[model samples]
Target: MSGSLRSREREMGVVILDGSTVRAFVGDEEVFNRSVDERFAALDLNGDGVLSRAELRRALETFRLLETHFGVDVVTPPAEVAALYNSIFDQFDLDRSGTVDRDEFRSEMRRILLAIADGLGDFPLQIVLEDDDQGSNLLQQAVDLEAAKTKAAASGK
Candidate 1:
């Protein structure tokens, strides 16, 4: 694959299962822990075992804000975003309860987090490292090319 394509793939967090553990990879480097259960607990808004659509929506909104503020390229379309919420609602409405409690919420949250993380490409750390390297190289090349151009201009040639 071309380097640019390979790098783009690396940017999209790809989780590979290694035995019982999940590991996120960027190129040859492992970046994220792939702990969906832990992440779900941390994001649970009400200290309940389950996560509701409101909580999930809050999380997504926060993610969107971070992406915008930080200039992150991850983008979720409006339709897909709605579908995601609907999927969670359907899953957590177990027993046709028409409402999600702690357990149901937690279960759905775990699945949603995993799915979102999976699509987000490597964890933030991995992306940062990769971008740092790429940025440095581009900067250096730009500097060198500018210097050459300057020299050519000076020679009036």
Candidate 2:
């Protein structure tokens, strides 16, 4: 019930979505890959076509993304934070290659998203997503995909 939440260029707003919303996103391979790949590319600061442990950790530190919950700070010890990030990095490195290639990253991301969708169940969850350029905008892409589908169906009729 908040104002529109969009990219940095647009006024910040909040949108409500649920399990079905995330399901739609994962179902649309084109939209999902494009959106998620953009994020992976940004995180691959070395331009190595893969994400190293340092790269992933740097992203977390720079963004403090996992630490703060919608402006609420959850203070954690540095050692614990490092371990958490290490575990996260390990999850993404599906092949245990010490780096997360695009495929590995994509596969891991898919699993994570599916888990989130399952957990959300039938509840309408409101969230503010940072710009796709800066952060994950999964919900926005899901909404846009559905809107495009509706528009296409209308035109076809």
Candidate 3:
């Protein structure tokens, strides 16, 4: 196999060492790629293809409030979460241009999730992933409700 492919397999292996099976990799890279695509879409608040530091930070802050607003607590301490966000953001901004494009964010986040699954990283993967799903669902519901309201208003016009 090629070096890169071998490396990917190795990384996947390490990520699975903790006994949690993440479905991001099934037979190939497509599943993980799709997840990344979905997450990037959701994270891109402005619907742009890039995520500015400010945009991501705002999202992080909102995520921090998940416990209070949505009753799903992923419990990363406030300061630690901020530091972790900054660290991840720095790593994702490879070009150091102060922004992370979709591709960059997806790749980095994929790696993060994998490491979390493997119990190899400092990030609280299990709690965050589980609670993040709930949080995202809540956010999506809110967005859908707002859209419906707007549609209703337009119809009444």
Candidate 4:
């Protein structure tokens, strides 16, 4: 992976540990991608290509630790979490294909990071920044996003 891509992944809360373990860190909360994938796969009932809102809600119930560790109150009456998951799923779906494959999942991660970076005022100031370094960084960002998506898909999240 490119150095720029690696840097972006680090910025987006992904930890590339030794032995190829990829973990996600949300505000000091750590979640293993493999574990999350297993949990989500178990929730994908009906052997369908996608997870319905109901299925996602059930998955959220199982993912209680996420809320606790992340310091995010995502789990509540269950319905609320379900709704939130539905929205999240839609955002991750990207192409609105009702299913999020590896590519779409990675794109969603990039979008999430971009949103956070934008919120933090870390992005470029100008309407359009013209520079090779900036262009290379942008390319690296895209590469990192793809890597993340591939990891997520392989992990089953």
- Residue 6 local lDDT, model 1: 14
Model 3 per-residue lDDT tens digits across residues 1-157: 2112111111111111221333224212654565556766787888868898777877666544434433445556679877878886798898888889877876676666566446533342322222343234322222334455569999995
lDDT of each: 0.45, 0.77, 0.55, 0.45
Residue by residue across 1-157, what tens digits does model 2's lDDT show? Answer: 3333323353455777788888889988987998889988988898989999999887666455544434445666779888889998998888898999999978987898889889989798887765534546666777667767879999995
- lDDT per residue for candidate 1 within 36-55, as digits (tens), equals 34445555767866666777
> How many backbone clashes can be found in candidate 1?
7
Model 4 lDDT tens row, 1-157: 2112111112232322221111122221222233234434555686665666566556445434334433344335767655667787787677887776545544554455445444535333222212322222332333344477789999999
Candidate 4 residue pairs in clash (backbone atoms < 3 Å): none
- Number of clashes recorded per candidate: 7, 2, 0, 0
- Top candidate, metric lDDT: 2
Given candidate 1, what's the lDDT at residue 137? Answer: 22
TM-score for each model: 0.33, 0.78, 0.50, 0.35
